[model samples]
Target: MLHRFDSFLASRRRFLQVSAGFGVSLMLPALEGRAAERRGAERATSLITLWMNGGPSQLETWDPHPGTVIGGPTRAIDTSVPGLQIAADLPRMAERMKHLSVIRSLTSKEGDHERGTYFVKTGYRPDPTVTHPAIGAVVPYQLGTDHLEIPAYVSLGGGEWPGRGGYLGDQHDAFRIFEPGNSIQNLRARVSDKRQERRLSGLDVVSQTFRAQRQVQAERSLHGQTIDKALRMMSSEQLEAFEVDQESEATLQRYGDSSFGRGCLVARRLIETGVRSVEVTLSGFDSHANNFETQTARCEQLDPAFASLLDDLRERDLYDSTIILCLGEFGRTPRINGLEGRDHWPGGFSCVVGGGGLKSGQVIGATDPEGEQTSPVDPVPVQNLYATILQQLNIDPAEELITPIGRPLAICEGSLIPKLLVDAG
Candidate 1:
């Protein structure tokens, strides 16, 4: 039922066909010139997704029902973003909250872990059949960045979304750099650049052999975009931006010494230089046995580092240009179990938003007390959140990308929450 992208989305599918036919030996300019010519735009328009891998407890973190018995041992504290109060452990984030907007009511139909995750990451419900690409992939597909030397999507920390360019083809897929320490693993330039070239040439010979015999289509099989992406990463200098150790000791300490903190720092640094979208996954939310206690520790680990990231962004004058998002697959149950934990609650949850010039210091929607899934005092869905984010980042939510067979799919399903927009801010 998406009304947009009825035209060119079909041709866009050929993007991957280009790489598939020729194989990965050669590279083409990404779709930047076209994206820049779009109708409306935003000056502040990059995105950083702070992914909480496991299903974080909703009762304990974002939609805390204090009066309810499930509220757990923690209490709420006021944030600098007045009218917003988060878990007491978020003292650091509390101070820089004026810049944040909280969405307390977000729901998805998928109940299982994988399904819920796909919903949040792709804006579309999972159909075990058609895999949806993560938002990082969508970022470059839409905006294409000004002049990115590396692939547009960058995932730091531990977790990463597995899907890529659903209908957009292999070339439009995300190039994930798994190593947290070094964005590129061992990409040193050897004695002669010719060595790597020769290797590529060898790859080309194999690909050409296949093309001569001819498959149904002229797509690269042995050396596809995925392989080429690795080759580019091996020789890329753009990865230097991921070095947190390069930052001053004081700066690193400010973000805290934990892995998640470092990941946050890395994401900011990646975007600061030129990466279009950097995702830092803070995994470890599946606290079924000791949910509350474990969440307290996780939030504590996240609070200061996350706060420092926001502060760092502001101090460096990067806040407006970049958007920060914190989310998980689903929220935990409202009732704590006998094991002293909460179960998955895909019915409703909360999300944190900042910068990208969003209308901040306001709650977009609400969940009822008792942490039960109910119509929000103001109702909204995950797609709205995705749509709002896209609009804020200057992406056209209405744009469409086609599936391989050529079924046009809207990039983002819902309309942007108008209240979250800045002119309305």
Candidate 2:
């Protein structure tokens, strides 16, 4: 009787183990499907970052204090919005202020170019232990790129410090295009179609052998996934979105003839084709000397491109679904240096954000007009800006992602900027 009871107990334990394993296996697909559904519902929006690569001066751009000691020769001009005005250099942008909101008190701690760019782009300080994903990378990571044949993140006119995938892996990295409107190199096969197919098949055989030898599954290998994505993108009709020349001559003139202008136009095209994020960089903002002249030239390239981008988005009925962020690594110092230049100032600066259902035509914070106070009024941290953006995109900023090293990190650790959101206010 004792032997029979023990046998029954052992069999019951095995059955329970198998049942548990089976139950977990069944739960995984259901969980994944739910997650997919949620992502699909949330991913209708896109982000366009107009990166002012080098630090631009607040006094010469968004937060001009004309007639003040630190305001310099850059004058302030009225905008379509009743109470708001921007630098006279951005006359075109000034007229379209009703579609944008300027944050005049964006403050950060990293002043160096590399560090500042990483912080502003990633919303986290540099940590040797783990690199955080850029906002662009995070967009695709949380949203999923099942709908895109082209890379979800794209960088036009690549900058010194372009947005990176960081801990999310290289698959999320931006596809860099040095110039817009040019044919993408290496996209088409140099050989005949038959030869290309034969080569691909030969490569696949070798890849299969390699996977078998290593005991690695083909689907689990990053290299294999990358190759698959490349092939898909090569054949994708979505690649045509990069052709800015397809626009009319009037449209081209409206956006200006500069590279940055064309980049902005291409950005709109990419967004229309379901790209999660697009960054159009306008470099040369670093003005350690000749701040006024440098800023004026930069703004000339910026004003028309930026204003026309907003106009196009609104005209195409894409404005409400696309978020636009125009900012840089930091701002130039309020004090003009001996070389007639403004030094790097992470103390306070300005960033313009609007669309994606956000409130517009409003200035969020202010700077000290007299320039006596270095700290800005109602100062906003870089993390808060990211948090607000994530919230707008339907991503939970507090959600934690476990790193490969078993460390967990939150997407963002800051609170939302209530005034920036349409529903929050």
Candidate 3:
């Protein structure tokens, strides 16, 4: 859907046939040039996003106002960090609190699922003029693609997928896999390497003619690059990272026996292999009805997996070099509705950020006792969150990338949250 290359070429099945018959492959257009080189010391080498989609409740997750009417039945539990408490459902994550920083008062104006997801992921709201790249897309752009065999960005399961490269082009789109531990389809070459070479040789003549025509060289280039990348990835040893079953049974148990757990494990593997950014989604957080029960269940699923991921990363010495972010488009309301479920509340919410050598074991902001307004602090906008992530990745948040329409847009418009940055060397 991101492109219209099919108009000029036959079906993919036929394109391969023509390549085999002709010799040279037509390349797809390279939309938008690569971002400028990383501007600062890299605080993190990779990013792992645990997307708690469908708008997780702030009260049941990181911002529980225990004993308050707004807190419902969710009780607060002590974390390893003194005086820092979270909802009881995430006891394991509570234990790992020393490795985390919770923003209890994240604020946003967009409450619609589509709009909030876009704002949080791209650091920009939906605009008629230009589509912005997701943080996942921008990270890879700033980091470059020298060592990546698999796509630089990978998305596990569903959700908004962070972003599909937006104006940065589909080249940066996440290589989507619906489930963890499943082999990617079409990865195996149907023909031998020698046969593939022959096919390429066959396509060379046709590609030359296509280039001579110059009617769609950019599109041709884009397609060729995409094919080349896919072919290389099909043969990449790094692809084995997706196989969660290869991990020990005990390790799997530590992460819990759920799809989200498997996804967390796979995320670790992908990050270890140098994938720049990866997002793992755990859906069904929308608790518009039966809010308490739904939130409790979702948090229970999130706890062990999230804790185990932190533990495994630390044991493997990957924790310091990786960042973990957990949040959704927005947070559910503080007031329990007639359905006993909370509605959307973009005014105040919570999110967790840790690792990447960030300052940890701290709470960034707070909401009132009733969980109504972001009290004692200004609201944390979506742009600030994006800026913080980019800063940790060594990408200058102020840098601009030219859009397809030639507009120079800043990667993130917000200033850095000093509390979240690494200590100056």
Q: Against the unseen true structure, what C-alpha lDDT does each candidate score?
A: 0.69, 0.81, 0.77
**Ranked candidates (lDDT, high to low):** 2, 3, 1
- Highest lDDT model number: 2
Number of colliding residue pairs in model 1: 7
- Predicted structure 3, TM vs. truth: 0.87
Superposed Cα deviation of residue 272, candidate 1 (Å): 1.2
lDDT of 2 by residue, 1-425 (tens): 00112332354345334323211100000011211122222436889999998999889999999898888898999999998989999999989999889999999999999889989999998887787889998997897765566777889995877787777765566777889878775566666778767777787788789888875554434546655665666666677888976799999999999999999999988887777799999999999999999999999999999999999888777778889999999999888899999999999999999989889988988988888888998999999999999999889999998887888999998899988887776
Candidate 2, TM-score vs. the true structure? 0.88
Shift of residue 112 alpha carbon in model 1, Å = 0.9
lDDT of 3 by residue, 1-425 (tens): 12322333344446555444333322222213221222223323888888989999988988888888888888999999898889999988888898899998787878898888878877787886777888988897898765556777888886644466778876666666778777765555567778877776665666667767784864734655756665566556677888976888999898878889888988988877667788998998899999999998888779999999898878777778788999899998888999999998888889999988788887888888765454427568878987887888789999989988798999999977878876742
What tens-digit string does per-residue lDDT give for candidate 1 at 140-180?
Answer: 77875554545567667665354355556556554444555
Alpha-carbon runs more than 4 Å astray in model 3: 1-44, 160-162, 192-197, 203-206, 214-221, 372-376, 422-425
Mark the 10 consecutive residues where model 2 has the least summed lDDT: 22-31
